[model samples]
Target: MTSQQHQRAAGKRAFITGAAGGLGSATARMLARQGAKVFLTDIDGDAVATVAADINRQAGEKVAWSAPQDVRDEANWERLLAEAALAMGGLSVLVNNAGIGSLGAIGAIELNEWRRVMGVNVESVMLGCKHAMAYLRDAQPASIVNISSLAAFKVDPDYTAYNTSKAAVAALTKSVAVECARQKIDVRCNSIHPAFIRTGIVKPFFDKLGEEEATRKLVRGIPMHRMGDPDDVAYAVLYLASDESRYVTAAELVIDGGARAV
Candidate 1:
């Protein structure tokens, strides 16, 4: 089949966790625009509804749906998957994008903070894969695009907890791909590792540095000389979720604007 036909056939029903945030929301909109029926979700119930409503208002009916979900809770994962299947008739893509970011040195970070970050970032991806596997198995051709970070590869100090959680996501993505292949599940799993996307997490950090210094420091680090937009990461994710990346699995697609290399 032609590439356009492949993409059109493959990208259909997609559910995005953490759809209220920068990267997730952008990804949801991108997928919807590409003719996929998207489901948006977040821990914030109100924010989830607003995002879904806004996307639907702009995109029209059958374009989007929003639900409140705690990715750490397996039951919520199951419920959301069932709801998505009911709404869209089947599941073709799952974006495990829900995550919490924490900043601190390893020795200075509280144990509770470390656990909370891991619970949200690492466990949530695990739950998404676990609960969605059955439906994905039945669907045959499906993809799970996980949201990891550049920190998963290498990292500076003062982000110990966040770094560890993303590292786990990277590892988990590989493991999921291997297991699915072995089980003949006809599913693909991969992680997208991005660096310093202009998202809500950057606002407080920028506020601390007064924007100017923060911008300068970040631009200096990234060879692209600016913070990567969430749409950059979203498009990378949409590519993996679509048929364009059908041969790709257990891969880490890094959209860091050359930050990780430099």
Candidate 2:
């Protein structure tokens, strides 16, 4: 392998949540291609299994594993981390990428709906960090990448719940980073904020407003005049997951195609 590839998570074991498709699966493929052993987990067992199988096939090695996981469940986090560490021999990277989008206005959003969004988007980050800390600490020079959304900084009335939940993730990521640093742990925690990545999460928008109009509206908002690809976010994840970012923690990397700048 090239020196750059070696520096980019070679032999590192990573556990990623929401690995069935989109950004999660894209990140998994990127990491495996860069020589990382990844544990891909999602609520959909069969889908995640297929993702893992595909990654292994592409890499021509057993570079990935898959398991059914509900990120909101604390016990599930514990079990998956244990099993992943055992399977990969150690844990070095944790990617909190599982989340759901919201379209309800704050006043119109039901209590249960709000709680559901917070549970999956906000609380799951906490659960994963809480359970994975020990393993990551043990594996020293570890990294935790939480996938927040640009909605954390930017806001919309229609995304009240999602925006609030992602903002919490950004805050939690900073807190974890500070604590880890104070403890002299070689673990780094960071969050990635991507806006309008062309993932399944944005399909609802296209469905509601025809594809052309939806794309135009989204592109108009972004200074770059285009939506982001899943691989764009995946490349960012790979950097954070790799040792190349050892000194980078408590950072919020935004991949929003300049939308946040405006």
The top-ranked prediction according to lDDT is 2
Query: CA shift at 132, candidate 1, in angstroms?
Result: 0.3
In model 1, the worst 10-residue window by lDDT is: 1-10
Determine the C-alpha RMSD for candidate 1 after optimal superposition of all C-alphas: 2.5
Best by TM-score: 2
Give the runs in model 1 whose Cα sits over 4 Å from its true position.
Answer: 1-11
Candidate 1 residue pairs in clash (backbone atoms < 3 Å): none
lDDT of 2 by residue, 1-262 (tens): 2355354779789999999999999999999888899999999999999999999888787889999999999998999899999999999999999999877997799999999999999999999999999999999999999999999999998989999999999999999999999999999999999999898987987999988999998888899999999999999999999888989999999998899899
The runs of at least 3 residues in candidate 2 whose Cα sits more than 4 Å from the true structure, single-residue gaps closed, are 1-7
Q: What value does the lDDT take at residue 35 in candidate 1?
A: 73
Worst 10 residues of 2 by lDDT: 1-10
**TM-score of every model versus the real structure:** 0.94, 0.97
